[model samples]
Target: MISNPAKEREVRPAPPDPALDGLLTLSSAQVLVLASGGCHSGYAGDLCCCLLAAVQGALTASSYAQSHILAPGQALALYQCGEFSIQSVGEGVCMLVQLQGDLPGRLLASRLTDSAAFFPRGGAAVREAVLSLSVLEDEHALVSGTAASSYAYTMLTNLISGPSSEAVIGQGEPLSPLVEAAVGIIQEEFPFLEGLDELAERLEVSKAHLIRTFTKQTGISPGRYITHTRVEYAKLLLRGVDPSITYVAEASGFANANYFAKVFRRETGMSPSEYMEITPRKEPPKRDPFLW
Candidate 1:
């Protein structure tokens, strides 16, 4: 994990990656990891800026006039006129990309203004790009910076081009208190959650009622949500230094290696081993230049 000392948080320049070649260049960028309760605040100035993704955990991002919670796979584009702050609700990690040129104009035209626009679920391509950046190996830090810039550009473009309906939150009906509580418990305890029955028991609600309300509100069943959460966690582990399928399986809360493989394949269209093979082996950056 990225180390954060009590007095300061280190921010490292985006390491170069050949895989990110052919994308738009960025003026500046950095990746930082926040421990529980860590906070990073800054001003946007004249550049186009965004919290490209909260790669892991939950974050509370706020601007002078607005604030929103960003879960994993979510992003927020900042309005250039104000100061903004991002705080980890728990242990969190995120990337900041600042761009020059016409990108800011494009963002303003796309309706980014006083309020920061939130991208609820940055689709698969965006997810993969962000993940790749998050896991870049520190050993390859000497490579060209083109790839890293391109990847950042690609993520921003994809987010801006998405349908606006899915980009904004707070417009729809708020989730029921029961469903919200259940989601909180799932996110925090996904690695050790026993089953739907256990979750229902914790909330003092019947299993059927819990399932119906959660599915209706979130568009996915609790069991499936649990599996998805496990799979997301597993993806991070599989992409990490460890190469053992069994270790990843147990760590991700699967009952057994065999069952883990089955569920993994069903969710990702590949076995754990295959997924690892495709992920690049990179170390975390050792040097840091910025502080948060």
Candidate 2:
């Protein structure tokens, strides 16, 4: 038995519909389970092929795992004390189906990139959801249909095959549907925002690409989008007290009162004071001494 025991298992998360997911599924795999156990049992085990293809989401074992590719007519006579999973379409051993024209490493990187915004700290929510789901094993029927299906699967390939740490993303790099989907989610969450680099880091796309794609897809640059949203929000505040021109500048993200005054005049075509004056006076605003 090994001192620090390990477990062996195969995991496949596929969806039924290539339209929704599982666009380009992996090829079938004929897996043999062999174990020299210090975990499930203190005994050696024999190797066996799953008599049939069973595409499954989660396979749990209390022992370490390893598998080898096999051509037809090949077999192993070995043993394992733990469990394993297999995906096959016939009585023959399985071959993992790589996506058509898919580059595994780049595809995987694209997938992980989708969660870049919350990665290292924020991906727990998505990871948990992925871990809990089982459809990722069901719909990989090996053929992708429709242009959308092909596009989606291409992205999945990018994810399962992670990019090198220093990998450069070129126009040649495979893009994933998940990447675009993640960007959409980020925009919705922080419509009026700063710290774009942090946000881009979380989204997992390069800051440059994020900027370009967002503008191409949405017709507005990221910085402009945030500034416009912030300015819109400031208008709501302007309807209240804190009508001082300097105060409005500070509250509206102007670094200096003079700068804020300039921007406010440009955006609204009037100074903050002038805007406040145009707004009808209501009842006297209650003030706190702390505010003064």
Candidate 3:
């Protein structure tokens, strides 16, 4: 759990997902569980085959002029190229599984549209399988490709056609018009703005009401949303040629570099340099690909 003095609110993280309970049973595939923040966006232009599972938190994806919000226990399968934006709602984490082998593109072609994109239930076993593969990779300090292709194919078949697709898609509770406006304001002006009191004043609402309303609808306070937006901005800058961490910090509107580093590490498990080193300068072919 983490606290934000900026809003005097405590963020009690939800229990970790148990989707990986069968990780040891997984026989094929190489997987990795990656930590991600509540807000971010990107494009995936050349991904061929991959699965994305949301073990924790809610994820909203928009592409092809359509949008889908994936609740916990849901997975999204992808097998083609397109630009997409995946945003974590509140505090969340996702898993990525790069299935080995030459996958037939049309294996998933029938269910690739927005209406058929998300698999709503039975995510735990799949998630655990990926975790098991990740453990194997970590133990060896190398990825073993032997028999991985068979395993990846099995995982995909199970996720797509193993069970009847009767799971209900999730939709967030709609925000009141005022609360929606507040969110828009924070997102638009956060880089140049600070604190929620001014925002509340501008909206003519009490700070307590503003905090309560926003948190109730989004599960995070307005102050924290601003922080997320700023941190997300820093992530984008760090991936680019910002000259130095100080420059990135300033660009993201942080008061100083040291503070920025502390918050960045806490929110995202890695420091800016470590993130830059591991994250490709160019967005990878797969963006958030791991599903149940």
Q: Which candidate leads the pack in lDDT?
A: 1
lDDT of each: 0.61, 0.34, 0.53
Q: Over the stretch 3-85, how does candidate 2's per-residue lDDT look in tens digits?
A: 11012223333333433222232232223223322111122223211211111111122223454332221212112223433
Best by TM-score: 1
Comparing 1 with 2 on TM-score, the higher-scoring candidate is: 1
Question: lDDT per residue, candidate 1, 1-292, as tens digits?
Answer: 1122122222234434433222223444455578999998877766555555565678888877888888765677775646788899988767666544344445345656574667765422244343344344334553235545545544555566533312122235787999878866665456567889999999999999999998888777888888887787677656544446775676667888899999999999999989988876433222231111
Worst 10 residues of 2 by lDDT: 114-123
Clashes of 2: 33
For residue 66, model 3's alpha carbon misses the true position, in angstroms, by 2.4
Off by over 4 Å in 2: 1-195, 282-292
Off by over 4 Å in 1: 1-23, 26-38, 52-74, 87-95, 104-108, 122-130, 161-175, 184-220, 226-292
Q: Rank the candidates by lDDT, best first.
A: 1, 3, 2
Candidate 1 lDDT score relative to the true structure:
0.61
| Residue 216 CA displacement from its true place in model 1, Å | 6.9
Q: What is the C-alpha lDDT profile of model 3 across 80-182, one tens digit per residue? A: 4356556777555555553322332445657766422566653432443453344445456543443233234445555655542121111477779878778
